[model samples]
Target: MAFRRDPKTPAMTTDLPQHVFRLRVRYDECDPMGLVHHSNYLRYFEIGRTEFLRSSGGRYREVEEAGLYVVVVHIDCRYRASARYDDEIDIVTRIAKITAAKIIHEYEIRRGDEVLVQATVTLAVIDKTGRLQRVPEALLT
Candidate 1:
């Protein structure tokens, strides 16, 4: 898996190719204790991945229009810390692996210098009829 610290770091520029997106924890997304709800972290990860794809020159709708649909096949997350409301978070995502019909993405949710969550998600491309299909070359490049 490609892992980059920051976009400008030499290791990031030469060794890894990943996307990073920033988000703010909203008051409405938190529980009464002021910590972000567990479920909402998944939503945040999704948004981060979507934005990563967008920056890579593709969008979910466009992929669907091309007869391809990505379905989440697996998701694993570990919460290491807590993020309170109004915290500025960084969602870092990278392509962990790619196969004929599947892609794996790894994510890290950080509040400043502290990592709050780490997740790995796997998605498979399928046709409308539910037959597995290879990811489009256009999408990869």
Candidate 2:
């Protein structure tokens, strides 16, 4: 599935590809309040994105081997509810947009039918020397 920016609105529109990753909240991921730590959400997003790419036939190791690295340039996450340890959650990752130099992803972390979090992440491709580069063709397709 290909995603394109809806010119009129500031949103991407298309039948975007999505990958769902399920995980149980770990005890260590929770804070004293028994809720998952805020920072852990970022790690969850990272894992979801990595698996999403791999499921699509791309690997971060392969990209790095080609002297390219994908880095998170920006991220926006909104916490809608709290997740406690031992809860089974599903992180749904979707490709929102893919440009020459960047790829944007949208995510939803849900417990059953309830959404716990929503996030958008922008990733940029760079060379070993930290110079901007176009996203690899293998990843875009």
Candidate 3:
């Protein structure tokens, strides 16, 4: 899907369209060591994706209502650093590529200027019967 800018929102221009979702690491999302749990980074990526879609004037619910579902087929996450509880971080998400039935997204979890984690995720579209389906053309733009 192409990123659409909202006129009222402040924008950042980049080579690849991206959305930055910022949040603080909550206590419940952290481990006993006060560091964010590894699993929580995936959740952050999901939030980033959701916000990215919303900001681009799209919604997952709308896709589902159209009888199409996007399911994650692959994910590759690399952790470079640890984030402590209460740390404010930004999850940068971009659409890396799109195919007939698959969309690839790249993400970076950054605490200020330091990238704590990077990931790539692939999602495939499917119909209600769970059969693979090509992504709708309307959703591409």
Candidate 4:
């Protein structure tokens, strides 16, 4: 299926205002129908989110080891197209909002000019006890 260009923005443009990460759709990620399974899209989003934090000088493991955790409190995604095995996709992540104890990220998954999925995720920072805590100061800068 031909992918659609999101009217809101061009897909996979180099000049996007936020971090862009590339990912490949593995053969095993596809279902018997030869299309990526719906659940795998969330994994793609998680990869993007993890890379975003890594690019920002933080990794999930480090954050967790530091006695803090980021739990996804809410997430929503809109699928625009199907990605097949071996397709190279780009995931663009942007910080939509940041607060003392929560962060909101927006994502666009694309293949060249075609957007396959778009999503917004909200995560909360908490300690091991699950009480909300402020995001680390270093990460906010």
Provide backbone clash counts, one per model: 0, 0, 0, 0
Task: Indicate the TM-score of model 3.
Answer: 0.88
lDDT of 4: 0.80
lDDT of 3 at 127: 98
Clashing pairs in 2: none
Can you write out model 3's per-residue Cα lDDT over 1-141, one digit (the tens) per residue?
Answer: 344444554331234678999999999999999999999999998999899988878889999999999999999999999999999999999987666688788999999999999999999999999999987754566
Candidate 1 residue lDDT tens string, 1-141: 333335443222123358889999999999999999999988988898898888978788988989889999999999999989999999998887666677788999998889999999998999999999987765565
* C-alpha TM-score for every candidate: 0.86, 0.90, 0.88, 0.84
Distance from true location, Cα of 96 in model 2, Å? 0.3
Over 4 Å off, model 2: 1-14
Report the poorest 10 consecutive residues by lDDT, candidate 4. Answer: 8-17
Global local distance difference test of model 3: 0.87
> What 10-residue stretch in candidate 3 is worst by lDDT?
5-14
Pitting candidate 1 against candidate 4, the one with the higher lDDT is 1
What's every prediction's RMSD, in angstroms? 6.5, 3.0, 6.7, 8.9
Candidate 2's TM-score = 0.90
Candidate 3 Cα errors over 4 Å, as ranges: 1-15
lDDT of 2 by residue, 1-141 (tens): 455656786444557789999999999999998899999999999999999988877789988999999999999999999999999999999988777788899999999999999999999999999999988877765
- Candidate 4 lDDT at 63 equals 76
Each candidate: what lDDT? 0.83, 0.89, 0.87, 0.80
Candidate that beats the other on TM-score, 1 or 4, i.e. the better one: 1
Clashing pairs in 4: none
- Greater lDDT among 3 and 4 belongs to 3
Top model by TM-score, which number? 2
Candidate 2, poorest ten consecutive residues by summed lDDT: 5-14
